[model samples]
Target: MRERDIVGREGRFIAEGKVVLNVLLANPAFALESLLVLENRLAGLTGQIKLCPADVPVYCVARDVMDTIAGFPMHRGILAVGRRNDRRSSEELILAMPDKALAVVLCGISNHDNMGSIFRNAAAFEADAVLIDETSCDPLYRKAIRVSVGAALKVPFAREGSIEAIVTRLQSAGFEMFALTPSGMTSIHDAKPARRTALLLGTEGEGLPKSLLENLQTFKIPMSANFDSLNVATASGIALSRFSRFSGF
Candidate 1:
């Protein structure tokens, strides 16, 4: 467990806290490997713990031992190791989404918190899927999952090779890609939603690369003076909210 603490063990990820543990237990997409909880927490989590397959082990340990194993103060008193069972390639993910879909495409978003929040927003707005480029952080990173409030577990996502590859696949799949940037040719409010829509976002400082921006339809959230743009995650929330409302979730 301690070894997994530093770097997620192989393909395994640590699901921490009561809420994240619950999501891991309830979601079949994640295959349970093992569970460790402070003895006091065992009572509260017993019901859910029992739902795990008989083969999956659940251990109750002293708080100090748990903390030592985690290499930190284990305030949440809960931890579980799980692996994703239904991994899909980017092409497959795009092909599987609904004919009328709304998705978020991320490019070069390195911050884990922003990635987590983006997933949370995607789930909140009932987005069909999230497509992240190679430059983005892993949504399954321990901190990212916790920041997402378990929304990362609930939402389906695929990490593709590059922004260009992602755009190509989405375009081939009949998606109308709208790149979100400050120098957009159109305003997000005036842009019409399509049967298959993708809202593309980039990193905070540089935004989307010129190559991508030049090729795709670009739109921006109109803002007042003094501020040129919003944070990537904030902009994503605003855009997702607008798109979901326009397209009926």
Candidate 2:
């Protein structure tokens, strides 16, 4: 199971923590294969276990045994394997949203922690969906799911496309794309919301590519001159919050 830390199992991800496990068991969109719980945790999770599909097995193991099997300390004492049911394309997902939509678009966000926190922010701000480029890390990666506090599972997301193409599609679908960068021309607060808006974010150090930045309207969070930049996740939270308020997210 620890191997999942490196490469997740095909079409499946490991969910940790009582909260994440509860999300896995609660969402019909995900199908649980099995649950491994510490013997001590089993009694507390009995209600959740009964809600699992009859075919799905719940294994109870001693704390030491669970730790040994997990190849780590396994402090949460709760892990579950699950697969997603709704794997929609980016175009389909975008098309399904309301005319006025708020979306978070990511480019070159390879850090799993950043990816997770972005998802959490997107969920917190009630983004209609998150669109990640082919270069971004998998939002469903185990550590990402864990770091997101299960928001990775809650937010709708799609990946695998050129950043340019993704931007074009969003424009074609009536979304006004705003590239968020430190050097952006307009302050995020001053930018008016469109019928549908896509907030494009990039890795903190590099920011968005110049070509993409030139192609779309750009906005930035107004900050003191002392700091060069905000963490990509933190920037996303601020931008999404502003956009969500305007878009009625």
Off by over 4 Å in 2: 5-9, 246-249
lDDT by residue (1-249, candidate 1, tens digit) is 454454445567877898988888788888878888899988898788878899989889998999888889899998888888768888888989998898889999999899999999998989988999998889988888998999889988988698899999999999999899988999888888788999999999888999778888999899976865688889999888888854554
Model 2 residue 35 CA deviation in Å:
0.3
TM-score of 1: 0.94
Task: Write down the RMSD of all candidates, one decimal each.
Answer: 1.8, 1.8
Clashing pairs in 1: none
> Which candidate's lDDT is highest?
1
lDDT of 2 by residue, 1-249 (tens): 455553445567888888888777767767888889999888898789888889998899998888888888999999888888768889988998887789889999999999999988998888989998999999888889998888888888888798998888898899999889988999988988777989999987777899888878889899998966889999998888788864554
TM-score of each: 0.94, 0.94
Candidate 2's TM-score: 0.94
Q: Residue 245: error of model 1 in Å?
A: 4.5
On a 0 to 100 scale, what is the lDDT of residue 94 in model 2? 90
